[model samples]
Target: MDSRGLIIGMIILLQTTVGILGNFFLLSHYLILYYHECSLKTTDLILKHLTMANTLIILSKGVSHIMTAFGLKEFISEIGCRFSLYVQRVGRSMSIGSTCILSVFQAITISPRSSDWKGLKTKAPKYIGLFLSLCWILYLIVNIIFPIYLLNKKVKSQNMTKAKSFEYCSPGDRDGIMDSLYMALFVFPEVLFSVLILWSNGFMVVILYRHKKQVQHIHSTNVSFRASPESRASCTILILVSFFLTFYTLSSILNACIAFLNSPSWWLVNINNIISMCFPSFGTLVLMNNAPTFSRFCFIWIRNKKSPNFKVAM
Candidate 1:
């Protein structure tokens, strides 16, 4: 393979590896929390789903990417192609929906107790589980065209006269009308989720700014107002969302270029792979670095390690 191909392969390998491990760490943490602590917060529940979806996106997108990067085309059968594409799209849609859900809920969570959404915040989690389930079903059904229109690249090489070919899969021809229909079917949910995220994120920022000013006024009167952990977590979400939007926008641009190009450049395709996986790979680390739960566990682990007789005491 060429130097560029080798470089891309290595980058994809690293990203998928880290993403698999980091997201599983987050997922397993929640499992441990549920079993050990006997319960989970609603926010924790939402984050766990996000982590799972991220893991799904990484796995489905990563395998083909790594193989293609290494020049291992048509590595799977037609069935495999269908499965991968379906899972990848569903996972991506789920991640988008989950992030929007988390942001909107957090905004409500930090809202003033006397606000209009006061009672809704407490009651929201009760129905969120069912809502996410319905959404997953909806996404799966909506993307069913993937399996129907796709065949392994190696399966019908001679017959694909007007189809777009991926590294390992070939999809049926999309005429102008079909293309527009497909765009509407898929892009609608994405646009809707993005709008929700932006609105909720803006609300959270405004709430935070107001809170900061209130704290400043209290300080001036010699009455200290400490920032709550919830506020800190909201700030973290804002930072995380900013990073996500940056990576996602870049990834989307690369995707658009590939779609619009006569024959997509291999370099652009490889760069898109890296950009797509960047957030899922390192987002977990960002969360752990700023998260109170992880820090608390680390502190405990360290303290226990330093105490030679800790086991005996216990």
Candidate 2:
């Protein structure tokens, strides 16, 4: 491989590795908490779903980008291409939707007792499963149409008159109607989810500011700055939303131009995938910083590692 290819491949490999491992650890933490700890909290359940989706994104997008980066052409068959893109799109959408739900739910959780939306605090947890189910169903159904129109790079026409190409896959057919449907099915939900994420984050920020002021007012000189679990979770949502929106917006813009670019550069395609996966890669570590259970789990793990079980030499 050339220098550029080598560098791109290495970067993708690192991202994929970190994203997969981090997400798996987070997912396991939540699962253990759910089964061993009696029951999972509502927010933890949402995070479990988010972590699962991030892992899916890593598997779908990371593999394709790595193969493309190192010039592994046509290694994937048509069915593989279809499945990859379908999984990629669905995972990306689900990740965004979960983040949106998380931010909104946290906002509701932290709202003042007198707030009009306070009742949701009691009722929202009941519907989380339904919300997640709908999210999966919506994205899966919408992206299901792409398989028939996708081709492995090997079989894709050099000049299908008009085509949208990815590094390892291409649209076998396209018309105005299909294009409209693509925007409707894929882009619209992404846009909606992003907006919701922003709105919820904003709400949480406002709530936090007001709460801080109230705390300060009551305690003139000796107020505790230590944040509560709700505050920390709100901050996590804010960071996650900020990180997610920045990359999500850039990826969307690049995706819009992919169909128009006569031949997109190597850097262009891989960079788009990189941006799409960036939040998933780093977001887990961000959550880890805030997750007390994860910290405790790590602490126990390291202590155990430092003092391994062994028979002393007599």
lDDT of every predicted structure (CA atoms): 0.80, 0.79
| Model 2, C-alpha of 233: deviation from truth (Å) | 1.5
Q: Encode model 1's per-residue lDDT on 40-153: one tens digit a residue.
A: 788888888888889988998899888888888768876886788888888888888888898998899999898999899889979888888898888889878757654422
The weakest ten consecutive residues by lDDT in model 2 span 148-157
Q: TM per model? A: 0.88, 0.88
> How many clashing residue pairs are found in candidate 1?
0
List, residue by residue over 1-314, the lDDT tens digit for candidate 2. Answer: 79988888899899999999999888877765565456778888888888888888899889988898899967998678788878887887789889889888988899888889878989999999789989899888877877754432244445564545656654555767677887888677767877887788788888899888876756645564676777877887788778888888898888778768877766787788778779888889988986676888666556656888832232
* Candidate 2 segments whose C-alpha is farther than 4 A from its true place: 149-156, 160-166, 218-224, 297-314
lDDT of 1: 0.80
Error of 2 at 123 (Å): 0.9
